[model samples]
Target: MSNTSEAIDNDTVIKEFIDLFAQQDATTLAPYLDQDIVFENYGSPVVKGRENVVSLWAEVFSTMERVEFTTLNQAVNGDIVIAEQIHGLALPGRPFAPIKNMAVYRMRDGRIVEWRDYTNSEYARTLM
Candidate 1:
């Protein structure tokens, strides 16, 4: 089925993207994201535009005392890579974001066009 195959492709992209992100390989990530990528961080303001999306992660994430991106589960539907990832941080953690949070990756044409972060503020404050 064309739809099924498309979903599989997007799923692979998501997995590969996550792996690259875990390694903080911006060069690799660059090709996969559009020039106008959009991202939203939980408990923080949204990051619009491609440059900000990439640079924000490069700068802010590098400050984490400790962090992890563990894929707990995933599902693919057409151009959507429905995934639940475990993201945790130890340094510069947001006061309203838990050490661990859930992230969603939305892909289009083998590139990540948009992403959203979700987390619990109460749990995040405990870390702070």
Candidate 2:
């Protein structure tokens, strides 16, 4: 059992956090992450800490013209939520493209403590 004062709905929190990413609202996204969050995106180095993750997202948002994630499928098991998604991005001169990917999140007290993303590095590279 969790020692936290309130029980957290893992599914709801995961969905809301992803929705914030789809909206490119890093400011709103920050609160949903644990202070010592750990994130690993495919083809990228592992990022640790909530503030560092936010900074990374800030850099991404600044570089891209638009970005969004369309959830294709999702499942929740205990404190883990797995989501299959289509990542859409519109760069400065490129047309919007869809990148198939999946994200696994581990939640604690309604905040994400660990997040790991899986996707094709070749496809992701093309976006750059």
Candidate 3:
């Protein structure tokens, strides 16, 4: 495959990955992740492996009434995709609010191998 095609494919995969999160379908997300995918979230221990990440998200989905992300800005460079987003969550008996955050995703072979998230932990604490 040409380099241009590979880059396009990588971007598509990353977009699909983000869509999966918006859909809150952890099961469907598994196929888009590398077997040894590493995921890091602000104020949380680094989660290793695709299966483990799926399990963790499943648990979170079970607890939250709803979770959604709106991409404010996104860019792709080589194998990396960076996004600034508004993440919103609705909890039982609590008003939903959007939190600003950023995520960097590294794609390999059309699958995300590494995902790192950045946000204001102190502000997030107040929201939770």
Leading candidate by TM-score: 3
Please, what is the whole-model Cα lDDT of each candidate in the order they appear?
A: 0.71, 0.82, 0.85
Model 2: colliding residue pairs: none
How far out, in Å, is residue 111 in model 3?
0.4
Residue range 12-106, candidate 3, lDDT tens digits: 78767767766776898899889999999979999999999999999878777878877888888778889898888777778886888999999
**Per-candidate TM-score against the hidden true structure:** 0.80, 0.88, 0.91
Candidate 2 weakest ten by summed lDDT: 1-10
Which ranges of candidate 2 are over 4 A from the true structure? 1-8
lDDT of 3 at 29: 84
Stretches of candidate 1 above 4 Å error? 92-98
- TM-score of candidate 2 to 2 decimals: 0.88
Q: What does candidate 1's lDDT look like per residue over 84-103, in tens digits?
A: 77665557545323355566
Q: Summarize candidate 2's per-residue lDDT along 1-128 as a digit string, tens digits.
A: 54222224776777677677666657778999999999999788999999999999988887778888878888887778899988887778888878889999988878899999999989776865
Off by more than 4 A, model 3: none
